[model samples]
Target: MLGLIGIVMSSEDPNNTDQKTRLEMLNDSVIKLDSFIEDILNYSRNTRMGVVMEEINFEEILEEIRNGHKFMEGANKLKPLVEIIQKEKFISDKKRIIVILNNIISNAIKYRDTSKEESFVSVFVECDSKKAVITIEDNGIGIADDKQEKVFDMFYRATKLSNGSGLGMYIVKETLEKLDGIITLESSLNKGTKFSIQIPNQTN
Candidate 1:
């Protein structure tokens, strides 16, 4: 529908300012819709595929995620602090880990409290022989205590502030479950949110 509108509007007289403005708006909507569809596809693909674990570097993955967000609209205003407390390689699905990190980071940026003096997202990783523990903290608009539990539910939008499909966290939880991992959340309204995740050091 949006595409058809855009095509029709494109044929309007070039001098018709009103038509041109509407066409531009429709084009932007189409771009956003395309992105939303791609995210849903990625979520579905991750859930259907079996986990493929291999030795992977924790820091390298974090750097890639950070670099990917450099061009995002408000990325510069939000500080992304990444720290690997214990440098260790783990056997895990690298792609899924990327998906998990990307979703969390994306949320941190999307839901940031612009009223604050500054906003930041911090990632900490601690790994031992048995498992790797990751803590992702974001100084964003925190989830209300009442809505915290539903954040992982499919299609649940915790806040009206979101323009996304609300499947990011759901995909995160599903992907983690497939790897026998656990995730927990903590937040205080108006302050921030923290996610503690644990994945096995070795998976069968």
Candidate 2:
């Protein structure tokens, strides 16, 4: 269905303004459907796989997530404020951690409060010999207190601002559990949201 919609949209007459606008909306829907499908597949795969913990440089992962080519355009516009208070080798599933960071960071950008004079995301990392704690805070339209607890549930969407598959947070929580990690959230309606993730450090 999505592929058919894309083909129809692509073949539309560019001179027809009304048709163009409708087609654009249809295209957006198709893109979202595609994302939803991908997220479901990822969630299933990660759930079935065993965690492969390895020594990884925490800062390097953050750098890749913030400045990576995939996010360069959005990061440039969002101007996320990332402060790595501690950078060191940690033991965890690198890929899963990246997925968690990417989803939260992207949500911060996607749901930014345009009403604010300035929109920003701040990331703080703190770790000890036992575990690593990552706090991602965003000055974006926040999750209402009533809805906060459900954010990690599969197919749960907190706000209309969410465009992608509602599976992002679900995947994050499931992946963390696989890694023996946990997450918590704090938010006030219209204020912002903060997510704190803690993963056990298995380094010897």
Candidate 3:
């Protein structure tokens, strides 16, 4: 990748279309490799480390996640609507929860249904002291009925739109298992996808 970058940099016509395309491709490859490495590290962390309990600030973290992806293409189209109803303080593994939400949200953005004029991702959370119920819904290119069951399976790519090694949802499943959480999904071919995840709140 470095050699390719050097070549692109040293090109006689710096603005050449072919060189620009090659550089773009190289940049994409780097991003993909970085995502894969992060996934691996996440897998190790979720599998090996014990859950560290902490108070969860839902609104703050959700906003943080939204800000992190504002630079993504089409992010502007998918406005995130967040609704939080919390009667009591929610306690859980903060990092793990962030990981789960980030993966799902990123996928929603990447596989968004471009045919629609209005697209949105809504996150609704209702929690008491016992557990947290999170629903993330997106108007995007959804998984087919047949493929939905196997989405959490290792390296399963339900659609060609998937670019990763398909470990995103696998790691999500693993992390949820570690947290004693339950995840369910609903989707249509081109309409959208909704994910409902519930995890027990740890009392510290």
lDDT of candidate 2 over 1-204, digit per residue (tens):
756766877887878899878877877776677668868877977978888888867678878877643422245556567766555557888888888888888788778888888888888888777888899998888989889989999889999877777899999998888888999999988989999999888886
Mark the 10 consecutive residues where model 1 has the least summed lDDT.
1-10
User: RMSD to native for every prediction?
Assistant: 4.3, 3.6, 3.1
Error of 2 at 117 (Å): 1.5
lDDT of 1 at 166: 77
Q: What is the lDDT of residue 105 in candidate 3?
A: 93
Give the per-residue lDDT of model 3 (tens digit) for 30-127. 76887889899998899889999889998888988999887666788887889999888888899999899999998988899989988899999999
Candidate 3: segments with Cα more than 4 A from true spot? 1-15
Provide the clashing-pair count of each candidate structure: 0, 0, 0
Rank candidates by TM-score, best first.
Answer: 3, 1, 2
| Model 1 CA deviation exceeding 4 Å by range | 1-31
Between candidates 2 and 3, the one scoring higher on lDDT is: 3
Q: What is the C-alpha lDDT of each candidate?
A: 0.86, 0.81, 0.88
Error of 2 at 15 (Å): 5.8
Superior by TM-score: candidate 1 or candidate 2: 1
* Pairs that collide, model 3: none
Name every residue pair that clashes in candidate 1. Answer: none
Cα lDDT tens digits for candidate 1, 4-112: 8757886789889987887878776775686589678878888578878798688888889888877555889998888886655578889999988888988898889
